[model samples]
Target: MSEMQDYRSSLSDPKSRKFETFSYLPEMTQDNIYKQVKYIVSRGWNPAIEHTEPEQAFNHYWYMWKLPMFGEADVDKILAEADACHKAHPNHHIRLVAYDNYKQSQGAAMVIYRGPIKV
Candidate 1:
């Protein structure tokens, strides 16, 4: 377990070339995704969806399918978009991100996993 932790820590280092700009905040699941996104929207954060193939899961430079900006009223739309991205990339890792415009940083994130880590 410590070895894996060390590996993850090394990957996160900026000089490692494997630095991740994103990460999962909670357990991966559809229900959790909706709940987290709803809470973020309630806080006035904008939602966005992104994904990447399992092989590139740790690459950090995942592809953004939808840019953040979906407002509270568009919660369902964003949720559906997240679902679609998961379906399209069933063999990949999908995530939902909420950006707090005022904070200028990611407000929250949730991942929908496809399988266990190779390690």
Candidate 2:
């Protein structure tokens, strides 16, 4: 039974990378991304967007798209901002962050767009 189990090796390429938790899963669709943003807004968490070049992603602090959306209840607006950021920096990795005010910390984060991997 052990032999029948499937096993997969981890990526060994130095350039091959993973960012936030969502990166490990399959690419999300527009509906899926909308759902995620909705979840964050439902929790009353502030949504923010950030971006960074593929190479700088692991080292430097990501560049904030704009100020965090405090008291933002409209999920569509949040998604629009994220989309705008992605459109502005199509070659950079785009991330969505949720700030939890009560906890004074990040409640959730995910890389929504992956920049092209430079070979």
What TM-score would you give candidate 2 relative to the actual structure?
0.86
lDDT of 1 by residue, 4-67 (tens): 4433444444323232332423343566656766788789988887888756766668899856
Q: Please provide TM-scores, in order, for all candidate models, with all chains considered together.
A: 0.67, 0.86
Segments in model 2 whose C-alpha atoms lie over 4 Å from true places: 1-15
Which candidate's TM-score is highest? 2
Q: What is the lDDT of residue 75 in candidate 1?
A: 68
Clashing residue pairs in candidate 2 (N, C-alpha, C atoms within 3 angstroms):
none
The lowest-lDDT stretch of 10 consecutive residues in candidate 2 is 5-14
Model 1 C-alpha lDDT versus the unseen true structure: 0.65
lDDT of each: 0.65, 0.86
Give the C-alpha lDDT of model 2: 0.86
